[model samples]
Target: MVTVNIGTLHNVLDHVYGAFMHRTKISPLFFSGGWGGSKLELLERMIKQLFPEVVGQNCPPTLVKPVWNTVWETKTACLREGVFRTPCDEQLLSALPPECHNARVAFLTPKFVPPQRMACVVHLAGTGDHTFERRLRLGGPLLKENIATMVLESPFYGQRRPMMQFGSKLLCVSDLLLLGRATIEEARGLLHWLDSEEGFGKTGVCGLSMGGVHAAMVGSLHPTPVATLPFLSPHSAVVAFCEGILQHATAWEALREDLAAQKAAMTLEEVRERMRNVLSLTDVTRFPIPKNPDAVIFVAATDDGYIPKHSVMELQKAWPGSEVRWVTGGHVSSFLLHNGEFRRAIVDGLNRLEWKESPS
Candidate 1:
């Protein structure tokens, strides 16, 4: 008889989940359409030309306006959502709907605190409709600790979601890339705003799933000292879309049918390679490590079908000295399996930060 350790079993199950559950469904349009063909090539070329080296380059500044009419007070804190216009020109905005042009947003500050010398965490919500209940549950612990938590509505999500659009619908591959750029820009603005505030102390960024990926991107680009914690996010967008469970929700089957009608012959592997450069724009490894590696903590799922273990490992390796906490079970289940542990990690990470006053 052979005895397999729990860790080994978990690893085996993770591979099983990856192999059986999240198999890729290739779409030829992913390599031929506007997002894939010359348009994508142009975008990649622009990135290379404009940002020969992404490191040390400053993110474009943005202005955020609070929706005064949308202000509300909670028992523990005040909730106010805002919207910020993306700086991208009309050409880029054409890819996204008008509603997304003005990104919806929000931030929470402790009710009674003066907000002076207090830590702030910018919490990015995962994909899908942004429910109020979900935000409260995720940010509850941080708010209790008197750490102001800011929430940025991801593009095509929440109030920015196009009218009558279903929660799981993603119109095209380009839409995802546009959303990625928008989220990163808005988050950068929010962080800058927090840093500029007189009462702001230490600032950190965090998110779950897609939000986690956005958090990592903002953490990498922002030069300011801050902590980053990405929960259950894949390190590579290319891998996540091409090989993860969420691939099904992306309408790949429809795209595949369309390609079949056009008699296009392309495999999943070929599609993945074609989208590599465009997707690399959001790759965690391509960005710089946070100012403090110790301040960066990753919470990953051992048996996550949506985010494979290799993706998390890639991010961990890229950010040397960063911490990673692995919880058992698949992506969605792991959140429930390790809720307490995840909360503690977040609280501990925020607490570990040495708060300091902003410069005059």
Candidate 2:
């Protein structure tokens, strides 16, 4: 069984985030997920396994332990008020190993909830009993496929608190919003981080479903990501939740209810308009096109009843000559159906980044 120490993971990530900030001159990698499947968890495990010793290096005394000293979730920094403060690396560096303090950090903003808790539970459960099955299914073979890592947890089964929260923050400013301003602001903040001297260098984005939309938006805005891979997802593709294609309640409907209850300053229509304006990444698609003119790879499910393939095609056409990969499956099935193969592609793409090759 692969033994993971949560405390270790926490400290290492802080330093790694600092290291990536130092090396890439770009923001930490942004990831989103399609519905279903533990994409975030799977990606973290894969990265750890692929680069076991790549944990942060040259740690300071203060980073040797795990501490929640940051104001991320405190009452002072509530998501409602738009105060998303995280603990800086320097603040947490004294609690980590001396040899592994400054490591590359992959800043992940999961779409749904912070899947950290659930992912840990799943990992722990697999460790005790179904160790072998876990490895074959989600850990070993599954991680070998799939290229791009996504962020959001699947809201198909139920609405995720974080996405709802993200939606709420934006709805206050305008009604009938598509993507929230907070989400966009956070995304842009990451972009600015990337453009800095120490963020990820030449980063890329890949997402599924709504996550796909996020990838499109970020890629459209940032020139760093040389490659983009969005699979079977789009922004306006709301068939499943809207028309009951999947017999599910759309996030839009839920947002309306929440808005009604809150009675905030912004009307639903105004909020929607603001969201549209901010998230209109499609409009600025031409801005971030690679200078080399290489087409990005956009994957879709031809049989995606939830998020129709036509939407994917529209993005392809709109991009004026980009790569598209159409698979045979529905929205969720597109990924779950080909878990192993999908994971392989994700790894290969990330491996393309030229990291300072460490001693094997």
Candidate 3:
């Protein structure tokens, strides 16, 4: 009899898939759009100014309602597509490219759930996830469990992608930061609307890959208790961009030259370190722990190429009482094959939190 390590097998597949896509010409390199010029400086300054206000504010920021259109309908659920101006403040707004000036979202909810038992989960976008269908599909079945789905379109993706950007290959370092910052603001606003407006009895936020990172931030910064689910996500963008498969897809030469132009002439290693420094701002572990750490769940891949187990565990450790569930598969495999597990995590995480008190 032979014992096989299924995890190693899938991990190899991930490595092969990543290498073929990144090592060859199949996928365009990230940051190929070159440096964002002044936007980089603006983002750096704003992050210092804005992180505390948005994430650590004394009161929640004002929320705005979206103008929605019923894009699709069905017997069990109706889907409403919505458009709202981006909620990022003036300085950050000016940093965004015109195309991403507005935020877009798709929401799917069951025809009915008792007001006390109603639930809604906001799904953030992962890299290259350009539409709501995939996220909706993941959250759709949960409607049976009375969990609605709200899919946020990440800035620099879908209808929000900038004119000069190519596919998932972000044009500049600042573009990446701006996208994350704007996403936090918009997601926080939507969560606020869901809690204070729609009044879902229970609300949670979840995402996979890059979206997972954002989900963790939103969950952490949110004023109230909400289930936080991060599936197949690293503790920080530093891991994804500097230490994982994405490193191959990074435009090292462009970054080196950009850093060189920013300060004194720089070497390739110096630029890599600088990139690490910039991406460090995205470490969710560095963010405040959610009010309900017990309500946080991380669904991680056992053999993920992009997100190492260490990164996932690091976040779990930082937020004590958060649970980590290990599913057998690699990054791509887990995303494609383990959605049932992802859905299960969402249900369990949401269940851990107390229902929000309904208004009079």
TM-score top scorer? 3
lDDT of 2 by residue, 1-360 (tens): 999764345334434543443235342111111111232233223223212143233121121111212213332121111122222243222321232222111221212332211110001110012112322233333221221121222211112223323321211212111122123223434344433422333344555555455556545544344445455665442332232142221234344444455566556565445334433422323333432223356766655545655566666776765666666555545556655444443444444444322312
Residue 103 lDDT (model 2): 19
Using Cα atoms with residue i matched to residue i, what is each candidate's TM-score against the true structure?
0.81, 0.43, 0.94
C-alpha lDDT (0 to 100) for residue 186 of candidate 1: 76
How do the residues 1-360 of candidate 1 rate in per-residue lDDT, one tens digit apiece? 988666555556655654443343422222122343344554565444223274445545464544534477877678776656765556667656787888666666777675555777888877663654565566767776777777777777777776644453555666677777667767887787777743477888888888889888778777676788899898868767767655543445444544455568667555445556557766778777777778889999876767888899999999998889988767656655676766666776766666775433
Write one digit per residue (lDDT tens) for candidate 3, span 145-202. 8889999999999988987777878888888898888898899899889878877888
TM-score ranking from best candidate downward: 3, 1, 2
Task: Find the candidate with the highest lDDT and give its number.
Answer: 3
Residue 55: error of model 1 in Å? Answer: 3.1
Model 3, residue 203: displacement in angstroms?
Answer: 0.6
What would you estimate as the lDDT of candidate 1? 0.68
The Cα RMSD in angstroms, rounded to one decimal, for candidate 2 relative to the true structure is 19.0
lDDT score for residue 291 of model 1: 78
Q: What is the lDDT of residue 146 in candidate 3?
A: 85
Which ten residues in a row are the worst by lDDT in model 3? 50-59
